[model samples]
Target: MALLDYWVLAAYMLGIVLIGVFYAKRNRSAQDMFAAGGQAPWWVSGLSGFMTMFSAGTFVVWGGIAYKYGMVAVSINLCYGIAALAAGYFVAGRWKTMGVDTPAEYIELRFGKSVVQLYTWAMLVYRIVGTGVALYALSIILVALMPLPEGNPFRDPNTGNLAVEWAILAFGLVVIIYTMAGGLWAVLMTDVLQFIVLNLSVLFVLVFMLQAIGGVGTFIEQAPAQFFAPVSEGYSLYFLMGWVCIHFFMVGADWAFAQRFISVPSAKEARKSAYLFGILYLVSPLVWLMPPMLYRVIDPSADPEQAYIAACLSVLPAGLVGLLIAAMFSATASLASSQLNVFAGVFTENFYRPLMERRGGSGNLVTVGRWITLLIGLLLIAVAISIPYLGGAEKVIVSVTSLMVGPLFAPTVWGIFSRRLSARAVWSCVLLTFAIGGAFKWLLSLPADGSISPSTLAWLTKHSAVIELGIGILVPLSVLALFTFVIDRNGTPGWIPDRSKNATSNAGAMASDLPARVVAVAMGLCALLLMLIALISHERQLEIGLFALVTSGISAAIYLLGTRTKIAPEFQRAL
Candidate 1:
């Protein structure tokens, strides 16, 4: 890396720390610490949602998947966008309407304290592991980007990379400082900035890669046929079906993303945020995956996961490489900070506050929240350091998270949407699914080193886990639905809204006007134009850059116009 690159990265790290410090004064209480005092602008929340979902994994692992597996990877990812849109249209409004600081509080309101407590502990563990894996993934990229001596102590081989371990600690400390300082307010602001940098950096790589490969037509002609297929050789129909189901449930109930819904000013703004997230999802994959896909055409034998780094080194100038690296780091930090804040909220609001109330302790809740944030950040660093020893960071992270959260999906979704399903029935379903899912994951994890028959092993390897996940979700939901029917025959279902907490009124409530409508239409057309130009244009570099600029400009204009409208009192307070 060049000296200029180092300077750029240093500046970004410093800037993020300052942003966190800048927002520190805003967190006067636990409520503000956790949910931005429930007055965040819709666009801020929307961008944060996008950044949280588009983690380091999207830049590295998903790019690798696209490089190796072809367009099927793209198809699979679109499931997330589809799920987000569905949630925006249906589930987001309800979450905002509930007006809770944490998903656990909402769970408590719907069920009871005991269930919420259990769910909180479970989610805490899940997020700690998840954030640790994200940090570990980012460390891998940083290790690749940085210059280390050949015999440096941080380059161990036998028990995973020591450089990765050091990188994790360094990145974790930075994330902890800011996240512990500003809470969710800092997270949203930094996320908006990070989203812009990462998206632009990705576009930079895409344009350069297209230029290097001659053009889009040349890329197509040189790439393997499988790279263009929607359903390639290794990906089975059952896997795709299962992937879609898991994503829908995951997005609908994701705690980190749901925090964005809770932070927005109103149910209507929450819904708008979701729609905005969906629009970004539609366009981002093209820019994110194209460089890696093109890299495969150039060097078919290269590591797919490392394609992004290789392209950066090959195509970008000195300072921009550092900028791209910073963008990657920013992606991971944004996610880790969000996770840390959410974990702090769940632990402080759901767990610690209740304990204090029981004992009649007069502890300052904001102070307690900050302490918990630091604690979670430390735990995440420890988990990240330990992840290297687990082998194959990507695979382990994905398998463990999927196994742990698969069971929670059905109960969470049903609990939110269905009036007939009782809390007791949901609890019963959760336990049953946990047991069965655990056993199924164990079975799938069993050694396949030719101990089993070839055909049976192939089938088991390809389909069992996805099929298991499908079963994990479906069987529990079916049982709950049936139980609800049997118990509530001819009587009103147990879907009564809790009347104790007041819901916030809709903010900036107005019918869409000419400029707003035009901007929306123009945004869609710009996205389509980007896709069309990338597909057909011979001057790939110039056209791709133009598309990126136009898309970004239009998006900025839309945001500025939205800000100029008659502002609600709640939104004004947030500002």
Candidate 2:
């Protein structure tokens, strides 16, 4: 049965790659490859952005986090949603207008080529390492889901462990081939399909868990109060600081999420996407978490990875487990495909393309990007194989990403909002954020091995990641503000002039005719209402069925109208 599941996964992955190859012809120009001609509908781009950010690891890892840490995990997710909204409202216009192929290009525009070069290197390092970690998690999930038969050649000879590494390697190779062939067009288009598969899988599993656990009442009865609490475990000042750091990371440095700005047809659509995603993203996590929660109810001592697989397998009927695991693999592919594509984009636009342009032939930029994808994929496979040996894979992954986010977000935000700030200020802020944020995060590490003193843990239980993210955002902004004020007491100089011009030209700024403020307010209100529902549902303050109905109704109405208003143009064009 498990082998059958693995075979199905391989077949499904191959089908996705073939689709990419078929669409490669449509991506003739670099613009088409990079931004899908900025033609994708608001909902498509919006959902893709949401789904891409909803990496497969989010469910498995976050579910585990929720199982272990309780509401703190949800707090972190809420922080991410806010970060996404902030980006949509404020920063995305400049990015969309710049018409740049990659985020590192923004660095070049704001500062000098040297700063751009430095940022490019930094981004490559951060993304590649992060991708490796993501790949490792994906592989671990697969190994857990589809166990290889004993004495099979696919099992490692030395330890008799299943060689999921090879399966992961094959999956990576297929993704790289398709991504390199089709670029962003293929990536975004396939992302649409992948998103559907993932969401259906999520919905299916959630329904199964709810039913198997004897509905919401039984599930809640079996679980601890903290299991449903989103703000309990992360309520401390220190943890609050951590949440701030995390928020900055998501809002600022996450080029993976930020890249959506370039894919949308206009800024109106971008914000619409953000608003829609804020709600859609809320439900997406439940797919991965609910099952684990159900599993934990069954076997309290089951490790997180084990619990995730077990819940998925047990809740899903026998034949469906294979299809569901393949769906999980599709989720993995969706994530890996995007990351590898972005890494390639960054390398080509920031590093190889420039170097090749200076020297002569730019033809090989694509070739080099393909090679980079292949190399990154292999390194990730190595990382995946070694995750089992790591003392604390999850903590290490989260901490490393958290520490690196400060440098990325600080300079980008400073450059965008404050035009007069000199390149020197930008450089200074980057160094300072790296130093301060990194130091603060390391020094105030949260129970390095997930163990905290009861009082300290109790404090964390009350505060959460949002509060930590607040500190992270404030500290960097404070540093930037201090330097900006001192350097140019009058205010930011070159930033505003360029920004004004960019805003006028950028597609996102074309919303000048709409009731911008009204729409913005409406979006905010809807987001707030949904968030309240999420929190209320968590606390079980209202009837579960009623709350779900209200939440779904509001979400559906907003999405339908928002789709017509913001997405219809692109849809018409595509048709």
Candidate 3:
């Protein structure tokens, strides 16, 4: 990288820190630190949600998949939009209506403190591993794209080069500092900026790549046969279906995404934010995957995961290359920051605060939260460094997350929707799923060349994580349903508390604010402008134009209706 490139990257990193420092004073309490004081505009929360979900893995693993497998990769990713829409319709509003600061708090409210503690511990582990994997993936890309200085001794003797480890530690520290300083407010605000930068970088790369590849027609002509196939030998229709199911459960139940729902200003805004997230999922993939897909045709035998970085280095100018690198870093940082914030919330709210008898003042709680955030960041750095010992970063990440979260999904969903499911039943189901899924995952992780039987090895190897995820969901739900019928025959009468009365009182005291409405309108206009740019530059004019028009119209309507109407009493009570 050039000196100018370094300067651009440094400026980007500094800018993120400044944003966090600017928001630091606003987080005067635990709620503000964890949930942005529940004052985030719908659009800000929506953009954050989108960025949180769009981790660095999108550019690395998913881009690689697109490079190698073609449209099938895109087809699978579209499941994200489906999941977002489902959450908007079914989960987001309810989460906001409950008015809890963290998902663990909501879980505790519905179930009990024991279950809440269990969930928090599980999430702490999951977030550490998940964030570490993201950091590791981005670090690998950075190491490949940005050369190290001469005679640098950072390289590990055993690993050949420890550039990945150094990169992880360096960037991870930056993320930790900013996240600890500003909390959720900083995360959301910086996410908005990162989203803009990353999308622009994607557009920039896509334009240059298409030109380099001799336009869309030549690019398509040079693509392999499977480039157009939605499903094939390894990735079958069953895999796609399983992937869709996993995403639906994961998106709806995952605490990181749920945090966004709870942090939005109102239940209505939560739902609207989800809709906006879905819109981004629908539109952004076109640009995100294009360069990598084109790179497949350019160098069929290259490491597929490096396609995006390779494209950037090959096509972009020096300063722009740095910007692209910053964008990649932004993806990693946004995701890591969100996870760190959520981790702090879970540890402090569900475990520390309650166990200590709520002894601390708000400032003390926030201080503790910041400390926990810093600790989690350090743990993630260690995890990232250790990732080189793991065979495949992407595979390990997917498998571990699926194994951990798969069991939690059914219980979380049922707990929210079904009064018939007793706490005992939920606990039993969770324990059973953990035992079974963990064993299955462990077996799957074992070396195929070992003493295991051929048939067993084949079953484990052929099924993939998606299929295991399906089993994880199905078995737990099945067990829970059976227990619900036999053990809780009468159901837990009035299982849901009468929060309505309290909610109504809270609602009466608060009024719908106008700033959120204005932000929503502004966001809609930005989306329309993005779509207009797409319509003019890309081949799919009709599709892009329609998307822009619809987004603009809906945004305008939302603003008009928001200004005229009062906040729903139930939603206000939730606040």
Candidate 4:
């Protein structure tokens, strides 16, 4: 890395650490630590929520996927906007009304302790594994670009540099410490700042990429037409629906996302914040994809990741590059800290402390939460270290997370909206989904020697996991519904919630004249203007620069207006 780059990165780290230290001093209780005292402005929570879900994985891997498959990769990310809207529209109010700190608590209240415990188990798996993936991706970028010593252990001859590995570990440790120390306050606060950095850097790099690629027309001419088509490999409408359904269920039910709801002041604010989040989430992918897409069009033979790294390095000056690097690290830290925080909260509130003590007060549980944070951090470190041995970075994340969505999604969805399903049905569907999904993947992995026709089995082989997942969800839900019908032979079903109580919510008067519609229209107009400039302009750099200016200006304007007017009250109260 350049000297300026190092300086910029150092400043970035210093800034984040100072922020964490500031929050650490204020983290006196579990509520302050875990929920940020529900005082986060809708803008802060909403933007950070967008960044937390987007992360480096989406930028790096999804970009690579875009390079290979065109726009089909967007199908995955578009799910977030759809999911966020659903959550904002429906689940946010319920989460606020329940007033539970974690999803496991909701599960326990709605189902039983055993079920909550199961959810906690799933959460632990999710946190450690997810951290491993994030760590792996971060390591790849840092190691590839940063300068290092000879024979460094972290460096692989076939790969890049080992110094980068140590850098990743060191950075991760710092994140764990702050997360463990400051709790959610540290995570959320740092995440908001990081989101700003990430967005700015992404915009900067995207503009540079378009300039390098000549123009939008040239890029489009050289790039695959399919790159703009946001459909999955199977090329079926069902795949899109399935993708949307899975994310809608997962994000709505996920503790990681739902905790934000609890951390907001009221149900109405949470809903408003979540609705705002949908727009922010939709824009995140475009930031990173511009570079990768341009790289594919400009230098089709180039490594996708390398292209992204080069784009940043070549386009951004040394100090700014360092800032971008810091931004990248900050992004990873934000995610890691959030994961660690949520994991601890879920474990203490729903698992270890509950199972250990029947009547323990909040104090005892809070103490347990602290210990779980440390423990989860250590486990994540171990997993992060092992990520290199797992072969390709992106493949592992998509594969592990993919299995989760297909099987877990439907039941979670069913449980929330329709409470008729019993624990038996839930477990049955989960197991059945896993079995079928796994089987489908196994079958698709066959004919591995390139014997299969590229056209017929191309999509199936490419997305065998998705197919199995589809079957897994479908079979289990169908069987469970059938089984539920048979078991209700006596004309009386079990475990249904009282309709009146189930519908009740603490939804107060939402802030009237929410600017969501106006902001949407403004952003849409800005996007249209940029597209026109990009299409009509003759100069490549001018087109991209103009596009960047418009997109960023609109995004910044919306955020500023939202924060100052509607969202500031929440943040000031929290402070």
Count of clashes, each model: 0, 27, 0, 5
Please give, for residues 102-168, the per-residue lDDT of candidate 3 as tens digits. Answer: 9888788887777877777777777777777788888887766565555668764544544676888
- Could you arrange the candidates by TM-score from highest to lowest? 1, 3, 4, 2
- Each model's lDDT: 0.73, 0.60, 0.75, 0.66
* lDDT, candidate 1, 512-532, per-residue tens: 222233344434443443444
Predicted candidate 2 versus true structure: per-residue lDDT over 1-575, tens digit per residue: 44444454555576668767766776665555656666655666666676676555675677677666555666666665666666667666556666566676766766768777666667666655555556666666665544555878777665455566776676677777888777776676566656655654556567767877788788778786577665553344355456544554464446766676666766566666666666665555555566677777777887875566667766654334555665666666666777777766777677777787888868755556667767766666666566567646555556555555665567677677676666776666567667765655554556645565767665543442443344445566676787677766675455333544545655332221111222333333323433443353332333333434543555456446545655555434332
Q: Lowest lDDT 10-mer window, candidate 4?
A: 506-515
- Greater TM-score among 1 and 2 belongs to 1
Model 3 local distance difference test score: 0.75
List runs of model 4 lying over 4 Å from the truth: 151-160, 232-236, 355-367, 392-395, 446-466, 483-575
* Candidate 4: residue 491 Cα off by (Å): 9.5
- Give every collision pair in model 1: none
Q: Which stretches of model 2 miss by more than 4 angstroms?
A: 69-71, 145-151, 158-161, 234-245, 364-368, 386-391, 437-471, 490-492, 495-575
Clashing pairs in 3: none
